[model samples]
Target: MLKNFNWKDESGFTLVEMLIVLLVVSVLLLLTIPNIVKQSKSINDKGCDAFITMVQGQAQAYQLENNKVPSLQDLLAGGYLKGEQKKCPNGKDVQIDSSGKVTEVR
Candidate 1:
């Protein structure tokens, strides 16, 4: 009778294969991180624009009805906006001073 050998062999990934996988994963992460950052910036910028538009629209409406410049308190009291206080709604505030220039108070 022929002798039979049946032993289980352990398997594991080689060092080069492991290193290749690690390098590939790192490269993919590097590629994806920038895109994620850009997308996040885009979202913030869009939100800021929308908030500015809402504020300006309400201010214009108040001015039209009153036939004069509208104050922040006036807008808050007139129910043109939901909040009792005026805020840019994106971690900012609408800045309108004695001059006509408006900026987002970040």
Candidate 2:
């Protein structure tokens, strides 16, 4: 059976072919990684902005109910916002000014 087997009939990828495939994959990754990072940052920024808007709305509601501008602590204590919601989604703290305007800490 060994004698009948033909070595030339077998086909397989050569080292150069494998290297080329690896190189292609590496190049693709390099191209996509930076864009992915940028998109992630953009998503975080948008999420933070939306979070601020929601918190601002809640603060306004609190002001309307109490007839006064509320501080961040007041919002938390009055049950207008949960404790976990004191910070933006990006881990930035949100502050309520005397005018009840919500701003994210830089």
Candidate 3:
């Protein structure tokens, strides 16, 4: 039976088949990449928002403890903040105002 088998007659993917598959993959990537980028931006924005909220909370706690609003440097100096300043995942920096409110600067 092995001797009778014809390997020459076995078929592989045609050039057109390969090209079609490549076209489909390319189209899928083209369609998917933009959505993925959008989703990543959205996730980063949400993460940054949460970070800003946490920083604001810390600043508020600091103000309550010290009986006055604290600047970012003061927070860092007082060990209320882990760092001198924090940069958001979206490349924005957290800003602390005189009232201890937190904002973001892109």
List the RMSD of every prediction in angstroms: 5.2, 2.4, 2.5
Per-residue lDDT of model 2, residues 1-106, tens digit only? 3667688898999899999999999999999999999998889889999999998998889888999999878888999887667877678888988778889888
How far off is model 1, as Cα RMSD? 5.2
Best by lDDT: 2
List model 3 lDDT by residue over 33-53, tens digit each: 999999999999999999898
Regions more than 4 Å wrong, model 2:
1-5
TM per model?
A: 0.58, 0.81, 0.78
Q: Look at candidate 3 and tell me the lDDT of residue 93.
A: 86
User: How many residue pairs clash (N, CA or C atoms closer than 3 angstroms) in each of the candidate models, in the order given?
Assistant: 0, 0, 0
> For each candidate, what is the lDDT?
0.73, 0.88, 0.87
lDDT per residue, candidate 1, 5-67, as tens digits?
A: 554454678899999999999999999999998898788778888877777777788778888
Best first by TM-score, ranked: 2, 3, 1
